[model samples]
Target: MTTQQLHEQILLKKSFLCVGLDVDLTKIPEHLLETEDPIFEFNKVIIDATHDLAIAYKPNTAFYEAYGIKGWLSLQKTINYINEKYPDIFTIADAKRGDIGNTSSMYAKAFFEDLKFDSVTVAPYMGKDSVEPFLAFENKHTIMLALTSNEGAFDFQTLITNGTELYKQVLETSKTWKNSENLMYVVGATKAEYFTEIRKIVPDSFLLVPGVGAQGGSLSEVCKYGMNNKIGLLINSSRAIIYASKGTDFAEKAREEALKMQQEMEEIMSLKFKV
Candidate 1:
């Protein structure tokens, strides 16, 4: 999806919530394990339950990759289902994939062409050459990991070089790449203090923010500094929503949790944009 398509969806839904589909067999309802593909079964209900309450759905690749081929198949089924059923809702493959240029191109093909995800999270540790391969695709996005929500983020991302934090340099340097306009970023909501400065560099680019509910990132602080004129924020909530009640009623409760976040986001956008 193009950036304008994303912005329009957020406006139409009155939401910027991106429900994270980090499906784990251990965490899903016991009832779903009886299905042919437990992971896909779990994801289908989650998508059907929360699609209207959210503008995006992000499937973190690790959860599926851990299960091997079965998991990989499940992940493909989940993305395919969304593409056919909810094309307006943006989808992100939270693969965090980055490697040498040639390998990066393959990873790009796996997610963008074969699986057909709207965006895929790419780690920038390998630098611009590693990432540019993913950016070469048309209308697809390379959501680079910037300031993350993890405790270890300070180890490298915050380190200053040439009088700028490593991540700040990433935001500045990446914009110069070919087709860089297709780039978006992953800014952890837990690092809300940095949003004000981060916005200074890429003010209009959509930020795929993870670390809201289960991670305790304040939604209000994220919107206070994270939102732009187009409401460029996709605050992701994974465990808190998907695992709300691991029972037969799990899907309904997922909607309830997503609705709460979406309602909060709607109110914040109203305050920020004064609709």
Candidate 2:
């Protein structure tokens, strides 16, 4: 999806909420395991229940990759279901993949072409050569990791080099890459204070923010600084939303959780844009 299309969806839905489909088999409803593909079944129900409440759905690749071939098949089915049923809903492959140039190109093709995800997360530690390959795809976004929500982020992302922080350097340097306009970023909600400085560097770029809800990143605090003229924030809530309940009413509970976030987003957008 193009950036304009994404912005339009936010307006139409009155939401910028991205439901993270980071499914865990053990945490899912026990009854779902009896189905042919428990993971896909679980995802289908969640998507059906909350698709309207959310503008995007992100399935972290690690969840699928853990189960090997069956898991991958389930992931493909989930994406296909979303594309076929809700084409306007932006899809993100939350695969923080980055490698050598050639390998990165293949990873891009896998998520962008074969799986048909609208965006994919990438780690910037490998630098421009590794990430630019993903950005080469037209109308697709490459969300580079910036200041993350994890405590370990302090180790490298905040380290100053030549009077500029490492994460800031990544943002600045990435702007010069080919097709840089297609680049977005991953700014963890836990580091909401950094958004002020981050926006100074890439004010217009979209940010896929994780670490809300279960991670305890304040939604209101994130919006206070992270939002832009276009409301360029996809705040994700994984465990808190998806695992709201592990019973037969899991999908309903998930919808309830997502609705709460979406409602908050609508209010925030109203105030930010004065809609």
How much lDDT does each candidate structure score?
Answer: 0.93, 0.94
Instruction: Say what the RMSD of model 2 is.
Output: 0.7
Q: Give residue 66's error in model 1 in angstroms.
A: 0.8
RMSD of 1: 0.8
TM agreement with the true structure for every prediction: 0.99, 0.99
lDDT of 2 by residue, 86-201 (tens): 99999999999999999999999999999999999999988889998998999999999999999999999999997999999999999999999999999999998999999999
Candidate 2 backbone clash number: 0
Alpha-carbon lDDT of model 2 = 0.94
lDDT of 1 by residue, 1-275 (tens): 88898899898888999989999889999999999999999999999999998989999999999999999999999999999999998999999999999999999999999999999999988888899999999999999999999999999999999899999999999999988998999999999999999999999899999999889899999999888898888899999999999889999999999999888988987877765
